[model samples]
Target: EIYYNDTEAKKYAGNSRIIEIQTAMSERAIELLNLPNHPCYILDIGCGSGLSGEVLSDQGHTWVGVDISASMLGVAVSREVEGDLFNHDMGQGLFFRAGTFDAAISISAVQWLCNQDQAHHNVQRRLRKFFQSLYKCLVRGGKAVIQFYPENGQQMEMISSAAMISGFSGGFVVDYPNSTKAKKYFLCLCAGSAEMNYTVPAAKGLDEK
Candidate 1:
């Protein structure tokens, strides 16, 4: 399922509705930043075809896109004329220096790291590393806005708990479950904070006992 080249990536990007949804999500996430200047450095993790970059550009924000897919990155490079773009993996940690960005956004990408059975622990570890990198890459009071599809309540808890443990505060979670599709989408925003210790309750249906 890896999009290995520009043409293959473009096929997926041609779906206007999905592109619109990704754009909407990115716009909503950027709205929460309340940044103070033009040319703000915004990072789009898992950027594909520059859909999010298009929205950010419309809002006058300077953006950088990163993704592991070469095809996807190539598509992004074509469409994201207004911003810098990179090919990188989120799981390996961001390459930028501390305080290099005003905000970061991830759209519908995190879930690809692992599957539902191993998601709880796998996602937590990945997110912890992500948050740590995010913390270093963003200025004080900067924000990371992430959106993904979680299998259930337990998955959501794993994500929130990881944020808290990673020294991020002001945590917020939003869930939209589509019953017909049997899927749940989650959006989380966490702010960097001094305190790093917090516990998340065991999710009610986690073990299915």
Candidate 2:
């Protein structure tokens, strides 16, 4: 919350490079969702400045966004984004009704769950609560694609394991794995029964292996 102060929020929302990358990542995350062309209700976790939600709006999907930073949400409100915005700390867990959303997406979020910023912060417990709540909120067969910059393999494993423990079945999809600047990690997840095989998307002209 402190990290994204008013000045920083304005700066972040105004940065062309940040906007471009965020838009690209949001588009990629939506692609991984593989939803029908029809509009669907979606959840945007850690939806800073509503940048990712803008992509959802452009695709004709209705969405609700939650973020921890008030300043960031201020920017979102000022932008008059279509999605409803909530100032929320996700680690406390989502309180949406059961099967409330058709799908979910998080861009450059989730990684914060791994960091223990305070004495009361338990990474494992928080992650478990988050995934469980998210799982319960999404409809059966619903999917979520979370794009994050993992600091290391351990963080990636921790996040994935938490999702599986919450009853989600899916795995990672790395895009542009060979390029340092362009490389991205997406945790593609499916809620409830796995009726379809979860296929990892091939890296764009790069070997993920």
Candidate 3:
């Protein structure tokens, strides 16, 4: 498995190149979420070094982040982010009670669930469990914005289909589809409700409304 231990975690947080990439991705994901103009609790899945949580906190939302790597969590703890941090694997699913959060967000993390990290690692089963937990954790009409890089069409379909089966509405949103380099995919989901229209800034000019 590709472990994010202390040194790796330090580089992830401190390296100039990596920090920019992580911060950019986090900003884009939050932009797509179209959060309401109010305070709420958010869940940051695979939050490494609190980059995404920083964005959420800036918007005045309370958040709790979870990561599988203890070293990553340690780095996040040291960052003094306003959010809480937990060291846990998403594949095993979240342990929070039902309807515990107002929204959830993930960045560059869900793709790892597809890996056969161990002999017993089953991607389909694990993905279902994760989604089920995620769906239950959000209040009715809550949202989840997960940004990921799918290796192929099959992988993309698998992720979206799992979320749908877990009771999430909505699907992938691809920005800058014509631009091969800047293209980004965000899985936008609504819990137990229809997808609402998100006002993409006219300046960004995303093809979708």
Best candidate (score: TM-score): 2
Candidate 3, residue 104: how far the Cα is off, in Å: 0.7
Q: What is the C-alpha lDDT profile of model 3 across 1-209, one tens digit per residue?
A: 53698898998789888777778888887776767788989999999889889988888899999999889888888989889888888889898999999889999999999866544338888899999999999988788889898999998998999998998888888777767677777888888754444323322436533
Q: Write the per-residue lDDT of candidate 2 for residues 1-209, one digit (tens) a residue.
A: 44599999999999999999999999999999989778999999999999999999999999999999899999999999999988888888998999999999999989888865744338888998999999999999899999999999988988999999998999998887887878999999999676666565654637643
Residue 197 lDDT in model 1? 31
Q: Which candidate order results from sorting by lDDT in descending order?
A: 2, 3, 1
In model 2, the Cα lDDT at residue 188 comes to 91
Residue pairs whose backbone atoms clash in candidate 3: none
lDDT of every predicted structure (CA atoms): 0.68, 0.90, 0.84
Separately for all candidates shown, the number of backbone clashes (residues 3 or more apart, or on different chains) is: 0, 0, 0
Best by lDDT: 2
| Whole-structure CA lDDT of model 2 | 0.90
Tell how far residue 84 is off in model 1, in angstroms: 1.4
Q: State the displacement of the C-alpha of residue 176, model 3, in Å, after optimal TM-score superposition.
A: 1.3
Deviating ranges (above 4 Å) for candidate 2: 118-121, 207-209
What's the best-to-worst order under TM-score? 2, 3, 1
Off by over 4 Å in 1: 1-7, 116-124, 175-186, 194-209
**Candidate achieving higher TM-score, 1 or 2:** 2
